[model samples]
Target: MKFKVMAFLVAMAAAVPAFAQQAGPTTDLAKLEGGVFTVDKGHAKILFSYSHFGYSTSYGLFTDFDAKLTFDPKAPTSSTLEATINLDGIETMVAKLNEHLKTPDFFDTAKFPSASFKSTKITVISPTTGTVTGDLTLHGVTKPVTLDVTFNGGGTNMAKKYDLGFNATGHVKRSDFGLGAYVPMVGDDIALTISAEFNRVQ
Candidate 1:
């Protein structure tokens, strides 16, 4: 019995090297192809955080969202992005807090059930980073916002199709969208962090 267990462990250890060589994304931006891409819902997320009275930070996320991308790897400035997030899907990890956030004092999910963003311009800063300026509509108000975006990687995904990934960070003032109920107490500025994966539209 002892010999059998030892042999099994040895075999598994030997397989690790081969398993690590499996095909995956490449960081080479020059190798990417330009086309339309749709979000891989399972591999994307939108996270928001805010300062809580200078003591701690509160975090939440919108689990139901989708995005479409018109990409141009050669001429990255021509790329465009558009996304819609379901405000009702916001999750704060606390059941009671979740309910409260949907109230009129906060998101008022009952009145505004969704938010949308449409890119107006993209300025490439490097092969792996850029700035995306767009109109963000939330809680019945629209404002111009810019996000600093980084190209994570791009290549053929496990599904045998080309895929692209990105990480972005930005911020907005709650007052701009009429969601500033707590103001200096809860927080007026909201920080947004996004991680997303997009696959070529086949």
Candidate 2:
């Protein structure tokens, strides 16, 4: 009887880790309702890079962008994101460069005040990783893009608020959307990077 008791205790001890693992990370949203979350714009960044002179890379950022995340982390595949970026808010170190970027030769901010993205599908690739396939609209042209996304981490903030972190990346072609005015001078591919923080609404 003592031997059987010892065996049962050992089995119970071994089951502890498995139970904790099943509990998963504390922020598992799948068990919760998918509600609206506000993007912490102050902690959000939308940056892009393009080849300069076919040799070097130049980077720029949009100072104004808004995003809404409707997420259920436990069921990552059901998550969706909608984001809008003001093209007129593109900022660069050089004032003249920023001005030129908004002209018809580039973004044509006068014609297209904003760019937007809406995810059509979200596929959970792993426990903390996923891909969002969506349509990105820029300068009146829409094209499909896939954002490789990963959940960074989330927890209660110092303000006693629940928050989430994410990083995503994708690429776009200038020519495909009719922003081909720069041609070989500015390189065709533009790399996009997004780092955003979201605060739970409730």
* Strongest candidate by TM-score: 1
Residue lDDT tens for model 1, 137-179: 9999999999999988788765577899999999999999998
Note the Cα lDDT for every prediction shown: 0.91, 0.84
Write out the backbone clash pairs for model 1.
none
Q: Would you list the clashing residue pairs of candidate 2?
A: 30-74
| All candidates: TM-score | 0.90, 0.82
Across 137-190, the per-residue lDDT of candidate 2 in tens digits comes to 999999999999977766666565667788999898889998997678888998
Task: Please report how far candidate 2 places residue 14 from its true position, in Å.
Answer: 39
**CA lDDT of 39 in candidate 1?**
96
Off by over 4 Å in 2: 1-34
| lDDT for 32 (candidate 1) | 77
Report the alpha-carbon TM-score of model 2 versus the true structure: 0.82
